[model samples]
Target: MVAPPIVTLLASLVHPAAGVLVGLGIGVAGGVALLVQTGTQPPLAPARSAASPARERLPLGLVGIVAVFATIGGVFGSFNVAAIATAEASGAGAASGLLLSAYSIGSVLTGVVVGAARLPGGPRSRFLVAGAVFGVVVPVLVLAGSLPVLIALAFVAGLATSPLLITGSSLVESIAPRRRLTEALAWPPTGVALGATAGSTLSGLAVEALGPQSGFLVTAGSAALGAVLTLATVLFLRGRAASADAGSTR
Candidate 1:
């Protein structure tokens, strides 16, 4: 939430490169702080015996979750480029900072609420709803004519983001085997990185070829794909559970 405003301030006061350097510095400091908190870390898991089952491959459901996260990341990447282009076209380049801040604030607020509340549904069901909401909200960004409108839509889009991400990670924890947990968890973030790169590159090209609004189309499409993948994953899991129950009866 704070990064955008701070980066914007530093960029305006110094140079854009300086702002980026400061952001990197802050990230490094955070890492250092975490590393120094060794006493707060959880105890290491017990070593597995040689006779234990070989490390299982990741489930298809977990791969679907990673894909959903990738689509979400694409939405974020496309929104960043589109927001900047739209703000610049409106002769208010600084407004992009506000737009991004609004997005971050919305996510933070929703995350807090979601953390405290006992939402009524399984992770998969909630994830499906969140994905659908995200997909539905992103396309409306293209209709934003004013700064406030754009910011509002950005915030709304952000509202669904936290739930989607939280549920995705939770689903990873639930679906992955203990032996493969670390590896499985890593894939979602990797997916996000890959998707962000693709989204930024594609959206940049789209904005250059068409207009600022065209970038939102990329986000909308990605979000829609995420929703579809989430549905398929839910169905796949249900089928797997049903098959397991039948086998157990036999």
Candidate 2:
């Protein structure tokens, strides 16, 4: 979250190479710390027994979750390009870091509150609402006339992000089969990576052809698509739950 501003400041004070090296060092340190916590890691599940064969196909609900996550990643990628362009147009290229920081801060604060609070409704409902809000907020970015207003809107747009992401993960955990849990969990991140690449490329083109504001349209469209996909998958998720309940009753 704070990394963008810190890296930008470092780049301005030192050099771009210095900023990259510092970021790499921090990432390495964090990886090392995670590696050192091996003792606390959960034990791997035992191999499947002959009576319980591994499923070859993934659940439809899981695919929807991945698609939604991809949309979120699209927002992030498009915002990155739009923020830099907006800041440059305003004659303050470094201000892009501040904009990105505002977005991150909003997400972090919301995530903290969500983690501490016992929110009402099931994960699917919450995810739907979050996705809708995300869709609605992103289009407003096109209306931002000043840097300050853009920053504020960016923060507002970020408020829905954490809930959407956290709920998506929870849904994945609940829906995925135990045998392929690790592989299922990985799909969401893979979707995000693919979406980010596409978003960045398309947004760059939009910004170049139209303007920075047009870049936001890509994010808005992605968000709307995510919300629709979530809505469409609700029935599939409910069916999964119903099947699970029936199995348990037996």
Candidate 3:
């Protein structure tokens, strides 16, 4: 959503392909700046032992589940494209930006709400619920008849994103081996990068082959898949907790 506007603006002045190049340039610059900033930061304290987690390290099953949800998060980028196309097709090109803005607004609100009030659930459970909610909301985008309505749906769909993201990372942090905390955190974004590439390509295809409205189903499906994985994670964790409890009693 953020890069597209820059691409469009630059493309109008240059070539479409060149716009992508420029966007990439900007991204590289920003990334380098971020790296420099982070590299300069000092460690808070001397290293210490990790809290005794449910495991020594994250289970492969848990890693896979987190990756699945991260992919669902990445699919939101595809939704922005599909939404923009739909808006332009409807002859309200001027309002197309609102779709992105509305979605972002929802994410911002999530940070605020999550910070201000505690939601009742672990990060994993909340992540599952958020994924499911977005799954249901994304499909409903097809039913939107006006630009405003589409924006509203986009906003609602975005409500789940940051919460899922924050919780997913927290879950990873909680389970990550002490020696590999940074490595564990890296997987979520890696999953996001792979998913975004695949999602944008597939979303473009779906829009071309299935029509813009139907293209949205891809994103919905991705979220639903994540929700399913999250549900399995929840069940697995519950079983572990129960087993641990029974053993303690014995």
Top of the candidates by lDDT: 1
Taken over the whole model, the C-alpha lDDT of each candidate is 0.83, 0.82, 0.70
Model 2 Cα lDDT, one tens digit per residue, 113-218: 9867887888778777777777777677888889999999889877867878777887787777776777899999888888888888889999999987788888
Listed in order, each prediction's TM-score against the native is 0.91, 0.88, 0.77
Error of 2 at 211 (Å): 1.4
Candidate that scores best on TM-score: 1
Q: Which clashing pairs does model 3 show?
A: none
For residue 202, what is the lDDT in candidate 2? 84
Q: Write the per-residue lDDT of candidate 1 for residues 1-250, one digit (tens) a residue.
A: 4565567767877897888999899899998998899885667867889997676788878878888889887887887888888888889988888888888888888988987788888877887787778777767787888888999988987787888888788888888987678788999998888888888888999999999778888888888888888888888887887898999999
Which residue runs does candidate 1 get wrong by more than 4 Å?
A: 1-5, 39-51
Name the weakest run of 10 consecutive residues (lDDT summed) in model 2. Answer: 1-10
- Which ranking of candidates, highest lDDT first? 1, 2, 3
Kindly give the stretch of ten consecutive residues in candidate 3 with the minimal lDDT sum: 52-61
Off by over 4 Å in 2: 44-52, 55-58, 242-250
